[model samples]
Target: MEAVILAGIARRVLDELLRNPYRTIELRSARNVMAVEAALREAMRLFLTYDPFEDVSTGTEGLLAELMEAKYLETRIPWEESDEREVTICRAKVKLVGLGRVVEVERRKGVMLARVRELFPHEMDIG
Candidate 1:
């Protein structure tokens, strides 16, 4: 479930990164895992605006599955940042499935959201 929650957080930042194209370096600012989790929770609550208590698939991974199937996310990576230097990124890229096309996120949010667009382009919109 952590995946779902993380995905949501990454998505939120992705939206922002895509909007300006200059925020690509913001992903390196995540200080810890807890911060990532918090960002994910915020994304789920604010953007999704769904109650976890009411939904059975409220787990982090569960949420990610829904978003992927719905064509929301394109890629995700599990990494840790401590030096504030953009040279330590080493997480593998995970593809987030859309409704019709397959989009791979080259760099995920918080730690790598600035490159989401270069990583994934809008090829198909199933919804």
Candidate 2:
């Protein structure tokens, strides 16, 4: 159950980081486990808002289980900041839950930098 919550938080954080407009994001609390748990709670709150019909009584365990079975479970964490101090490398430690194996997916700084440009190509071109 804790894994499920952590996975959800990682997914949400990664998603937000990917979409972040800043060229460099400074996450001072990235290493704190309690901060991570707080992020999980916030993500869960956001999820509940999207689907008001979902039963709150069933809790995150059931909801996360459903997401896992549907193949929608993926997570990412800020693994390291670049030596050059230019980019942050986010890693997906748990690619899939309930698969009986741990799959790692590292999103390098170069890739994420390219992704940000891809997201707003016109803006980059204008500058």
Candidate 3:
């Protein structure tokens, strides 16, 4: 369940990051496990806003399962801050299913999200 929540947070952060490239965000800046949980709640709220009849009681767990089943995430790696450091400050990468786009992030003690940012062209190994 923790993995599900983290993945959803990563997706949301990735979506936001892609829209505004080069902006860095502290993943847990809202500052706690509840912050990630709140993001999930907000997502459910938005879904309900459009489809009022839809059931959102299951919250993010079902969504996470679907994402995993659909292979929405191509890769999710957690490592020490020393492993990779750019001006962006991310220490991990989460590559989504299509388009090969990737989101880099930093996680502290393997539990809390530290920071995140979109990868630049050169950072992505592109010419």
TM-score for each model: 0.20, 0.18, 0.20
Question: Order the candidates by lDDT, highest first — what do you get?
Answer: 3, 1, 2
Stretches of model 2 off by over 4 angstroms after superposition: 1-4, 7-58, 62-87, 99-127
Question: Predictions ranked by TM-score, top down?
Answer: 1, 3, 2
> Model 1 off-target regions past 4 Å?
1-6, 10-12, 24-120, 124-127
State how far residue 115 of model 1 sits from its true place (Å): 16
lDDT of 1 by residue, 1-127 (tens): 1222232235454444335432322222223233344434444211121222222231211112122111112233436644332332212222233211112222245431211111124442211
In the range 8-116, model 2's lDDT, one tens digit per residue, is: 2333443343354222222222332232233344331111111112222222221111111111123444456544433333322212211111122122321100001
Q: Regarding TM-score, does 2 or 3 come out ahead?
A: 3
Candidate 1's error at 70, in angstroms?
A: 30
Model 2: colliding residue pairs: none
Residue 35 alpha-carbon offset, candidate 3, angstroms: 12
Cα lDDT of model 3 overall?
0.27
Each model's lDDT comes to 0.27, 0.23, 0.27
Clashing pairs in 3: none
